[model samples]
Target: MLTLDDFTPVTLEDRAFFLDLYARYPQQHSDMSFVTMMCWNHYAHYAYARVGDGVVIMSVIEGEKTFRGPIGPRDPAALEEVLDLAVREGCAAPYYVFDEETLDWVKALYPGLAFRSDRDFADYVYLASDLDDLPGKKYLTIRGHLNRFRRSCEPVVEEMHAEDLAEVREFLKKWCAWRHCDESPVLAEEKEAVLYAMDHFSDLGLSGLMIRVNGAIAAISVYDDLNPDTALIHFEKGLPDCEGVYKAVNQEAARLLAPDRTYINRESDVGVPGLREAKLRYHPHHMAEVYVAEKTDLEKRHQGRGEI
Candidate 1:
């Protein structure tokens, strides 16, 4: 049986182990990515337990513990162990399913079990071409914004380097000030996560692009490959000094990734209304959906099933 003791905190040392497992399983959601977990470790408190050919991930946020379905080969035994552990530990949400395949597998095992979709956590995935080309009438408004920003700012797009980390940190300070990150707990946590990523930029194998408007960095985007055909943009920030600097950075990041990747995952909106609106304006190709099983629902069906 899987126990809390079997789980260990996620750290840089486990990078190779996770990369190997992820290479075999290939995750669809940004949260499953090793870099995302490592960078946000301070906020999410990620830990994992290896189970057979798979691994079970758990996170503690504000003292609330949650577990995710095992990520690896399709092994019913592994799934049962995670479910049992979640139930025994009394996690409010028994466990989470981040990909459709895992959801289906869980449903197959317990046909009576109920799962709830978390719209706030659903990742917006876009065709790399759509973002890069801004084609058709759907993108007309975005194209106008991008064109106007280019005309007004004459922004120069450059790839981020190790030497640029200091400048990037300064830019982030200005951005945090503009956004009043200190006023909100969530934004403060995000600021910490971003800074952690920047601090370990090279160690995390991250690549990014920066937009310089009149010799000063106005916007920046950091991204890395999530899978063979998908690139995940982990952090993006733009100062309001430029009217459309955000749009410019968005398109520039797409242009940099489109040639090699088929899709770009901008991650979840976390129920932020303004953030959701901005992401939707890009017109996602599809959402990499997420679902969770409530403890009550799990207890109802599997309470007495000693093994499950």
Candidate 2:
């Protein structure tokens, strides 16, 4: 059976393989992206093993071991094997079901499993146009803020270049200092992850915009197309050079990436109150709800939850 020992660490070297596999399957959540697995591997400790024609990814996060996928195509036997490994590892909730569709598939196969919604990690999905346009009365405040930002500082959103790496690093240092990232483990790890993504921008297939105000770099966004119809913004950061700068970079990134894509996934808020409010303000087209499944009688669990 599959086990952690059978898996290998996810790294830059496996980018092409993972991206190709994900392209065929088309993931809805950004957390399952290869870029995410590699960049945050230090904190998330991602590992994977080939399962039939597809692959299975697993990670141990916050002292809990979890499984994200048998990512390419559905293989019942392979999935069963992975699930067994999860239980053997004593994972309280092993499966990290990305959406309802995945949960449905798993349930149809297993017939009796306990699954619970994981609101903390559900991805906020938005129409690419909504972010670019900021239309209607609801967005009036955001639009006004964007306008005020433009009036005070002539902002230019330009394609980030290789030579711009130094400036981006400098900007991150200042940004971290302001946020006191060094004092907190979570922020410190995030800083490390962001730097890794930036450092390997080309290999990671990243496209981003650097927002400059009055000829000085004020904000930057790093992103890539997550699927044929969705683009994912992995990291967006800025100093308090001006309020609403984050919103400006966000809008610009959407405007630039939205031409061919229909949606943009800004990822999860992770139970952060301020973050949840900010993302909610934009009005998501949908939230790709995540669920955690543990080994149990599925029918009983579903009955208790009223067929949810």
Instruction: Please give the lDDT score for candidate 2.
Output: 0.85
**Where does candidate 2 stray beyond 4 Å?**
295-308
Candidate number achieving the greatest TM-score relative to the actual structure: 1
- Write the residue-wise lDDT of candidate 1 on 1-308 in tens digits: 89999999999999999888888889999989999998889988999999998899999887888899688888889988888788888468858999888888888778788999999999999999999999999999999988898898899999999999999999999999999999999899999999999999999999999999899999999999999999999999999998999899999999999999999999999999999999999999999998989988877765445444
lDDT of prediction 1: 0.91
Backbone clashes per model, in order?
0, 2
Residue pairs clashing in model 2 are 112-298, 113-298
C-alpha lDDT score of every prediction, in listed order? 0.91, 0.85
Per-residue lDDT tens digits for candidate 2, residues 57-83, read 888887777776687677777877777
Best by lDDT: 1
